[model samples]
Target chain A: EAGVTQFPSHSVIEKGQTVTLRCDPISGHDNLYWYRRVMGKEIKFLLHFVKESKQDESGMPNNRFLAERTGGTYSTLKVQPAELEDSGVYFCASSQVRIVSTEAFFGQGTRLTVV
Target chain B: TQLLEQSPQFLSIQEGENLTVYCNSSSVFSSLQWYRQEPGEGPVLLVTVVTGGEVKKLKRLTFQFGDARKDSSLHITAAQTGDTGLYLCAGALTGSARQLTFGSGTQLTVLP
Candidate 1:
């Protein structure tokens, strides 16, 4: 099966611009997650989706960032009025099951640079 | 607050040498997972340790979980150049919403 796939491996935009990153999870996967790393920081969780419903979004940074999974399939993360601090690598991952034993497959990640 | 902290942010060693990396936390977790990520790619799961005091070995790599489920370690014996990458430790907390908290990561360089 194909691994998690993300589009626009790298993105460069001016500050205050809006950017949307897309992720296509593995077929039949029920769990989807978004994470990001800025500078030397750890990979921080952003949000999770179980099908089209959001499972948890406590990790979301602020109101400028939004994520959605439609039709219980692919997901998208949009950053409106992006700021300089929002420039980082955004990773999308998915797992076959929700349990601990299932390994999450991550995409190559979209490197966003807000200039 | 960061739930997990890894020591020795970076390490550079010659090939065939042995090295050990640590992951520690004050909060208890249901499980901990280790991942290796190379440049331009996302992290790949190396191993997962669930039970406290559990020790699992994958070839020359050994993983150990603390007796309190608050810490873990990864020991790479006879490290090779191929083992060079960023090592990350993530903790899965207990409860219905299982989100993973990751450490800052250790970047290892194995010189040939």
Candidate 2:
């Protein structure tokens, strides 16, 4: 079975530039999540999608960040006019979304560096 | 905000030694999970403890959940070089969405 996969393992962009990160979750999984980890900081949750609907997006930092899951398949997170603070590693994970503890499989993550 | 605290931000020890890492929080959680991550890779789930005071062992690693469901511990016996990585503990607060609040993380190094 294929695991979660993310695009552009490393991205380097200048401030005020726009960047988009993509995530392809495992097939047959209903739950997809986005997370971020800044330099010297632990990983933090960004949002979660259940199929095509967003289950929870309370973790989104600001309006500059937009996430879309078209057709409930792959997800894309776009950062407009990225700032220095936007430099971090973005991770994507997928699970079955069950009442019981369903293990979440994470992608290698996209490392973004905004200079 | 719910936060998980991890002790010993970093640890370095010789192989074959034993060590224990802890995760604590003031808020009670419905479930807790442990993950190990290597550089250039994402974190992998190690174990999940739901019931309070529950204990689960994975080979040389033993995991224990606090009786109050507010704390947890990971004990590694006969640590090996393969065990060296970043250990993270996450909590799912009761009545909240499936989002997990992760701890500060503990970096463990096992020298060969």
Candidate 3:
């Protein structure tokens, strides 16, 4: 089966611009997650979607960032008025369930650069 | 906030050498997972250890979960150039959301 896939492998935008990253999860997977890694930093969770509903979004950095998984198949993360700090690699992952120890499959990631 | 601390921040070793990386935390987790990420790629799950004191081996790679469930270690035997990448450790806490808390990561470079 094909693994999770992300769109626009690399994106470069000017400061204050808007950017949207997309992710397509594996077939029959119900758990989708968004994460990002800033320069020289660890990957951080942004939010999680279980089916079409968001299960957790506490890791969202600010109001400028928004994520949605409509119909529970794919997900999109949008950053409005993107700042320099928003430049980083955005990753998407999916799993079959939220069990205690299930493995999550990750996409290659979308690298965003704000100049 | 739950935090997973990984040590050695970076490692550069010659091929056929052995190395070990550690992940520690003060908080107990119900399960922990290790991942390997190459440049321009997302992290790929390596293994998940759910039980305390559990040891799982994948070829030359061995993973051990702490008896207290607060730490874990990864040992790579006779490392090769293929093992060069970033290793990350993540934890899933009990009663919390299913999201994972990831460690800073250890960047490994194996010289050929």
The top-ranked prediction according to DockQ is 3
**Which DockQ-derived CAPRI band holds candidate 1?**
medium
Distance from true location, Cα of A89 in model 2, Å: 0.7
Evaluating just chain A, the predictions reach TM-scores of 0.96, 0.96, 0.96
lDDT of 1 by residue, A11-36 (tens): 99999999999999999988899999
Q: Report the error of model 2 at residue A56, Å.
A: 1.2
Residue B38 in candidate 1 has what lDDT?
A: 91
State which candidate has the highest TM-score: 2
RMSD of 3: 1.4
- Please give, for residues B1-112, the per-residue lDDT of candidate 2 as tens digits: 4389998799999999999999999999999999999998888889989999999999999999999999999999999999999999988888887888889899999999
Residue A48 in model 2: lDDT: 94
Worst 10 residues of 1 chain A by lDDT: A96-105
Q: Which 10 consecutive positions of candidate 2 chain A have the poorest summed lDDT? A: A96-105
Clash tally, candidates in order: 0, 0, 0
Q: By TM-score, is 2 or 3 better?
A: 2
